[model samples]
Target: MEVRWDIFLIILGSALVTFLPRVLPLMVLSRMELPDWGIRWLNYVPISVMAALVGQELLLHDGQLAPLFTNLELMAAIPTFLVAIMTRSLLGTVVAGMISIMILRYFL
Candidate 1:
């Protein structure tokens, strides 16, 4: 059996590229004591990112804004938003969103 050195190098390089960006921040940040205000702001990052992504999905379709009743993304998002508010659980919100989208796709 012959080992492909070119493929092996590509795979190794890919892993390093993928891993460094994610781990390097943690390695650098873990040693520092962040201020309370900094910590509070950092905590909002996930929710901000989620809102950006969800807003993009719900507001855009075929390079245009979709109407509320005709938009599956908007329809699914409403229930997901409610679930997030009611349960306050990230996992439950995500699950409810997925299930809502799946049902909307199947029936509508």
Candidate 2:
């Protein structure tokens, strides 16, 4: 197989554009002490982002807001949410969600 130099350059440039924004902030902030309020607020970012992602998955269908029962993704989320609450294990919750969704997709 022949290597494509043009594609390689595009991938390299794309990666740099993505990587620099993330790395530059960490490098600049490494030695700085953040305010207490800022540290407290940053803690919520992960949960907020996860909630937004889960919301997008459960609530949207074909780029539209789907009705509650009619959404297969939302249906799958029910047991996933339960597993997350009960087990409190990330791996278990993910595996349960995947299995539930695959079964739901096959039947519904």
Candidate 3:
């Protein structure tokens, strides 16, 4: 068996590059205390990111805005959003979204 040192070094460097950005922040922030307003502001980050992703998927086609009346994914998202809001259950919301898309694709 032959070991390639160049390949090994490249893999190690890639792993370090990928890992540092994620872990360095935690290492630096774990010892510090955030203010009340900062904590409250941070709570919105996940929701904002999720909304951006979902909005892009549901509203865009071929990099252009999709028509509201004819976009099936947008139609499916209606019930999925309602399920997420009403039940607040991740599993239920996922199931609702899957079923909605399946039905739409099968029938239309």
Tell me the number of clashing residue pairs for each predicted model.
Answer: 0, 0, 0
TM-score of the candidate numbered 3?
A: 0.90
Overall local distance difference test of candidate 3: 0.96
Candidate 2 per-residue C-alpha lDDT over 27-107 given as tens digits, one digit per residue, 9 for 90 to 100: 988879999998999899999998998799789887999998778888888999999999999999999999999999999
Global lDDT of each model?
A: 0.93, 0.93, 0.96
Cα lDDT tens digits, model 1, 14-60, are: 99999999999999999999999999999999989978987887899
The alpha-carbon RMSD values of the candidates against the true structure, listed in the order shown, are 2.6, 2.6, 1.3
Candidate 2: list runs displaced more than 4 Å: 1-12
lDDT of 3 by residue, 1-108 (tens): 999999999999999999999999899878889899988998999989989998999999999999998899999999999999999999999999999999999998
Score residue 88 of candidate 1 by CA lDDT.
100
Estimate TM-scores for all models. 0.76, 0.80, 0.90
Best candidate, lDDT-wise?
Answer: 3
Cα shift from native, residue 79, model 2 (Å): 1.4
Candidate 2 local Cα displacement, residue 25, angstroms = 0.5
Clashes of 2: 0
